[model samples]
Target: MASGDAGVLRQVQALFGVGTVVGMTDAELLGRFLTRHGDAAEVAFEAIVRRHGPMVLRVCRDVLGDPHAAEDACQATFLVLARKAGGIGGRERLGNWLYGVAYRTALKARAGAARRRRHEQKAAEMVPEAQAKERNRHDFAPVLHEEIGRLPERFRAPVVLCHLEGLSYAAAAGHLRVTEGTVRGRLARARVLLRDRLGRRGVAPAAGLGALASSRNALAVPAPLIEGTVRAAMQIVTGRVAPAGAVSAAVATLTQEVLRAMTMMRLKGITTGLLFIGGLVSGAGWLTHHALADRPEGQQEGQKAVPAVEVPDRDEGDRRVILGTWTTEIVIPRAVDGEPQPPLRLEETWVITGDRIVTAQDEEALKVGAVHESVYRYTLDPDVTPKAIDLTEPGWGTFPGIYELDGDQLRISYGVGERPTEFTHDDQRGPFLKTLKRVSPDPRPVTPLFATAPGGSWAIHPDDPGGATDKLTSTIGGVVLLTEDSPDGSLQVTLAHPVDPGAGPRPEYRAVAFDEDRRRYLLEPTLGGTGGSARGGVRVSLQRFRMDPEVLPEEEIAYLGVEIVTPGALLMEADRAFERAEAAGVEVLPPPRVGEPFEFALTTMDGEVVRSEDLRGKVVLIDCWASWCSPCMAKMPGLKALHERHDGGFEIVGVCFDKDAEKAKEAIESLGMTWPQVLVPDDEEVRRLWSEGSMIDGLPRLLVLDRRGVLRVDCAPEEVEEQVVRLLGEPGQPKP
Candidate 1:
């Protein structure tokens, strides 16, 4: 490709002006640059650097915070690209791809910097940059950045490519190897979550955050940094580089995985030939195994291989044990539309062999046609406390669960992501648990029931007859119902909760049923709610619908009644469940309460200790807020107004929840908040108190206190002034 480029360069120069590179596509320019190694190569490389330098700098700056570090990271990023230029295909969106590499590079740099600071005995800090104008700007930027970093890699990669790098949706999708629609949906969901979180913190979503996230705020790369990067790139091309001390600082920072991804992107023409050869060489047996390998799926790669556990030799007694079908109850303690929901009795039938365990819905599940069955190849370690069991499913990966076996009853619990260490079912710490009792003899074969059963309108009844089931609405087959094949070779049924099409997808009840398990058609249905603010704030009803197929024929019923799990109910129940689990010594959030003694020592942004006891005998207004909270920032003017209005009688103390202390300090100084504010410490106790306590689920919360050091009123940002006035007027011991 680079054999004869001097003549081509001269011809291209004659055809187009120096500035006419703008008219040429990235692919065309890249092609020219690849073929020409002398002056033409330099010009093409310069143009590419100039075009993408600002974006690369912006990403590094956002992640690294320090300007010096950002510049170094930026140069290193471009250098890596230059070294891999031959591998980067002409059709690839080099700019977006560089953004991803920059992100990982910046992260690695930050981690290294943190380790250095930790290891250094003496503080090497110098100028504090107190007067830096840029430091004081973008108060919410830190919060936005932290949240973006916390996003799952799948979503984060797209966001970084599209928003930070300014790539179009299609371009971003291509770079990430996903469909454009998938990119759009993920971005939409991510934005909703960000908006909801920001709103909860009292920050308005429109506070230039959306604009700043895009490339519109790209910071220019300094002349020296660009020059240094170009020099480094040239050196790298000539193979004149040495490894630095740490592994992170090595010249070739790109991992083999990243190199493979780059190769895939560029290997368009020869992909088929390469794949055929690569496949044959790698082995057809390995390919066949991987073809059936379960998909590693999660919000992140939460799926991990469970170590192969060797079980004891099977005996007659062991084979007979846990062989029959069983049933259990599942209850999701959530609140729908501010109302608590009743416990749901969910049943499941288990069929166990020497080394296999299969679960399906009982005969009662047939009322709702679709049910999901799960089959697992399990190895049980009976000797351990809370007997450990490793289950491997064909296409869904493996999970580690705990089980307790008795003569006739068995209890099992499993979690979604990690292995369950305990056998509890709390919302936070506990995994989903099932308690099953073996039936005396297997019932009739359920396969015949599926064939002979009359199909029509059928009512769905909960096992718990006493619970309220009025709000649920069920239908046989329509927009409301969907059925698919379960992983366990049973029918998977999903009964949708009645929802306004405008609100988007909410929660629905799912059931798994086996056509025939042993002698009975196993069916088990569970009821729960699953909507959140992501679907907007529209609240729906949570009512359980009665379904009794035994009493009335399926044709007799005009419509079926199924439980509708509302979002509000789900959220409420989740809190209650978490609290319950925590009380049982589970590692859940610690719930804080109002009217409790307000005691604690906090260091102000200026590094001064301010204890609650020290502020005794004064009318204190404790402000809980964060920089990312748009509403919190909006209320700042009003807070400042209040502080100025009643400085003598009232004392305002701000508690900032910003993860970055520098960002919090800057926001406070920029807003001109004279009141003493303390950055909230990231301790477990503090985190739990804030998360579980109703006093701080959302930000911009104001707590008013009397001079006697007793809690007065817990009010919203808008109502703080009125509440303070009332507290000030009270006849409690006046400030001495």
Candidate 2:
């Protein structure tokens, strides 16, 4: 080794404490890197870099033909690996995965370099004759890389382990969990495939191909490149690097590009597969129809259809029956070990389409406005005594269950770790049961229940339980209730206080259930408790009032002590001033649109006022987030990075929808959110801003306003940085 390489190796060994991670597998190292924090994670990640850096560097150098560019591409590949460590499949063959990543990153870097060279006037003159000739000699390197990448994984993995990484057949076999003979056979087959592919690309000499592969095996990656890559990976993982140099910025850019590309490719594959399956299903239906029509009447009546189509085997029949929208109310027994507790009942909607199931619960939907869906791919086995079902979610493993189908009504009993033999439920142990009723024969997407409910203003009167009335008394007043549709499809119900009109009615309740058939709406008052049960544990239910005007005059209706009120009827009585004040105070704003100005002035946690007018000259990102939003909290780091990246050119104004300001503040502090935040519940202007500006479909919504104060993009948190960058590139309006 060179003296510089030796010195750098010593430095890395000392800094990373590499001895502790010795003999660890790639998966073990990756697990430690992801699950552990601080020094422990750094050590594991550094060990990974030390183990695989040379091969990655070799791939980068062969593609880019520039040492500096190669180093950047190598670092970016590791960064991608770091970001995707948890989602990566086939951990034992990590080297093969890294080889593919390295090849792709290098190719991207090479294309970028070519673009830059085209823009540079002295680009051709910059390279010396010797270096030019050397680059030409390795012209076939890219073709070899492409062909190797194109090889089927099983064939490619052994070649990557044995030829590129220089592992023995036995070691490769052990890593792959296959026999040595199998590894040898795969490698031999891989070599023939590569040779044939390279020849088609006009590289005919077998000797030259062998020399290129051997050269890749012999190339030594500099220790400093390994150290830089390890340090960059560690910094990027912790979100500590703010692109201090061009290379650092390039690494971040390249990593995001590759990750985005990979995501798009995966989505494309899924879409194509789904389309193919749909075509197959359509074709099968057509063929089945023709086959049935072509048969004679007697044959059709007496002959049994083939098992594949009309007489679909047990599993397929079950699948056909289960495909559609189903509704269920799951009640978890509250008694734990004979101790009495409130039984929790959840209204869940499951939409089963093709082989996938999407479940949405009403409790979460009412709280967040957007229904959080849990998706799983399911398979049914009807041959069992009690029909069996297994649900599989990516990264979550499989959940086994047993099902019973009785026409429109279906019952499923599932367990976390084991398959239940019978449909039974136990409070403390064993299977949990859910009885579902098919709502629609055709599969339909589950939407928030409140989105489909009626909204307007009504006057409510308390029904006297004692059934006593005093006609002489005249001081009893009625309550005005206003129901509005929130941007996210939740019903926001506000009750105006009987005595206090200036204080403004707060959003204290949400419509939980709306029975269209019964024409009844169940309003659950949120009193800082689960299920929003009212005080003294009494749940309130409202029914539409149906009374004749002859018996009770419309004017005298407000005076009646009846509990029900007509939907969408405004009270016209002596308390007109109070009614008008309440309506004006809690008026719902229209949904915000692109190119429209979003105006708001609200106080921050530190008692400072922030207004849209004050932020006119800069690009603004309004993050509609809450403390309870897990997805919002997950995005804080990226938001912080964007804040740091733009310096003073961009600004983020947080519109926190959290009911408790302290919790929101605590989350901001813990997550290092240094932007100006406006608490929605604390300030009226901020509340209006949230209702109008946000798409309101979900928490963690992001709204971007350009320098001209025009609303540019209203998107999810993941798309914030891209939108902000796009806006920042535009010219700002002149200061008034």
Candidate 3:
């Protein structure tokens, strides 16, 4: 051992007494190490090292000939054990588990070393004859370890305990909680299996493989190595040292690779079983018959069928005239059971290609979000009366409609779940009409600028109220900006207040267009309340424009301002004041601290009022979501599953930021969101909660509250269930 390792060994021995946990089992030692803190935990972990360190080192050394690399792999094996102690199954057979981990870690280290060597040397270089022979002599060690690790648990446990650890059959049986005869039989069968596997790889094994076991048992593990491993593992688990800092980078990388491989193995097994079950369900004869019955008329069995409404000869002139990019803002009239409901303002875009017309609304855009891109396709029939069109979505069936194109303007009228006859907006229940303006003669490619735009809190400065020639020093409220690339080559910019949500007027801008020559970004503001609805007919304009500096400094600040339109509207012109705000850099508010009281009172869809105080006895999960946020909708199933698992002990309150209450209600019912929901923009209390907490920065934001109504965790959608489970296990009394 090295001098540094010797010194560490002496220090660890003096600090922790190995005799304190002399008689503990592997499971007992792991339990103590996980549950205890400080000296007690170190002592427990040290004992585990002393017991299994020799076997693990032997396995690593056999796989990797280099002594230093073997030691690194051994330490990484123990590190993985420390990190995954709680989730490890079959704890009693921990030696077997460690054997597998050690073998895999050694393999990873060997591959990495080989890669480094190849990179450092020239391609023409080759190993000498003597060196190649020596390498070939030891090639069976890795193969031997691989076969042993692949054995089923019933056979592997005895082999690992007896042959690898140098335990007698009786001792191995005792450790496995089985009879000695069973251990002897399993070991005999394991050796026969190993010999056959080795023979297939062109390496004949010695009879019984007893010589191999004796050699491994004779190789003594250095005390300093064990001591150093234990110290590093303790520091890592206690958060005193990160895994990478505690060990060499190669070892850390090897450890992570092994862990990822193990997780993938488990997932693969689960996926295979699910696939088998799915195959069984899909193979049912009656299901196939039912599927065939739904095929289009005049379609023969196993023959492809074209769409029933497909035109034989396409109208080249009509298709060419409509092939470009177009955009529109329209109000969708909505009602439920003949009751007049609030209308939904929708911003839509269409990109018509030679064969298909791609249409996307604000809601459909939200469904794809940033992680995915989807387009709704439509087949146009310019030959029919009023120019028929049929829109088709993947999950939704086709809807028949009519369209008319005149110069740079286009109009379309369509209905959901039915076909429309005429182009009119008078019948609220029959057809929805929209008028769109052409943005480009040819389909324009989505600019990379939107994909690379800076996001976060940006300081805002309106035009100087004093009407001074120079820029103003004072500022109004700041805007928290988030930008995403839409599939139709447009930028979706979401604007909100970074601090004091209710202090200023919140404007919603759904899509943005950039002008290259003038170095200006045009934002078309959707006229609506902050809750996502417009009461009157929709209007489109170049409402907001930003002048970006030609060369941005290191801080990445850009000047933004809105052109003066309606005086009392959300946006106004301020060219000079906007330049001042850009020089000030970005301003981000401090996030709300944990354990802060998150108080709110809002009415649910059932007309029953719910308050934070009333939910004091149960763990509460406040889900801030909107119907137009696709990522939020994707998270609903997991939230519903969490609610079902802890129904009585936990509660979820959804703060819906949808403009239309009826639409929110429809989404809630469709997604089986049985939890109480409060619609925003209509409720002042919910709006105050959003503004005060500064939680409008993103969608699908989850705030977990303890039984005492104190915020315990503020997390994303994926982390909600884990935090909820942990908080549910804690005890807290209701606040008086």
Cα lDDT, all candidates: 0.53, 0.59, 0.58
Q: How does each model score on TM-score?
A: 0.34, 0.37, 0.37
Clashes of each: 35, 1, 0
Q: Cα lDDT for residue 462, model 1?
A: 21
TM-score of 2: 0.37
Question: Residue 455 error for model 1, in Å?
Answer: 25
> In model 1, how large is the Cα lDDT of residue 597?
58
Q: 179-247, model 1: which lDDT tens digit per residue?
A: 676677667756765675567666678753554565556787766555556555655555545234312
List model 2 lDDT by residue over 1-736, tens digit each: 9757765566566565634676788888888898988767877887788788888888888788788888888888888888778877658778888988898889888877787878978634567899887687568778777777765455677777887788888888878777676677667656766676678679765744665567546456666666666667777678844256524677778777777766665564445334433332222221111110111112221232211112233455777888878998755544311235686666888777766665656643222112223446688888897899987643234668999999999998876667888788752343668789999977774532222111111112211111111111111112223332222223334432221222232112222232212122334343322233433332222222223323332212211211212111111111232333345553222245677887656677788988888887788887878889899889989989989999787899887788887788789889888889877665655454334333253677777888777888878776888888877776645432
lDDT of 2 at 424: 82
Off by over 4 Å in 2: 1-19, 122-133, 216-218, 240-247, 277-736
Whichever of 1 and 2 has more TM-score, that candidate is: 2
The Cα error of candidate 1 at residue 554, in Å, is: 38
Q: What lDDT score is found at residue 2 in candidate 2?
A: 79
lDDT per residue for candidate 3 within 491-607, as digits (tens), equals 334443221232243233222222222132445443323332222321222222222223321012222322211111211122222323334431111134476776666667688
Q: Report the error of model 2 at residue 95, Å.
A: 0.3
Q: Identify the candidate with maximal TM-score.
A: 2
- lDDT against true structure, model 2: 0.59
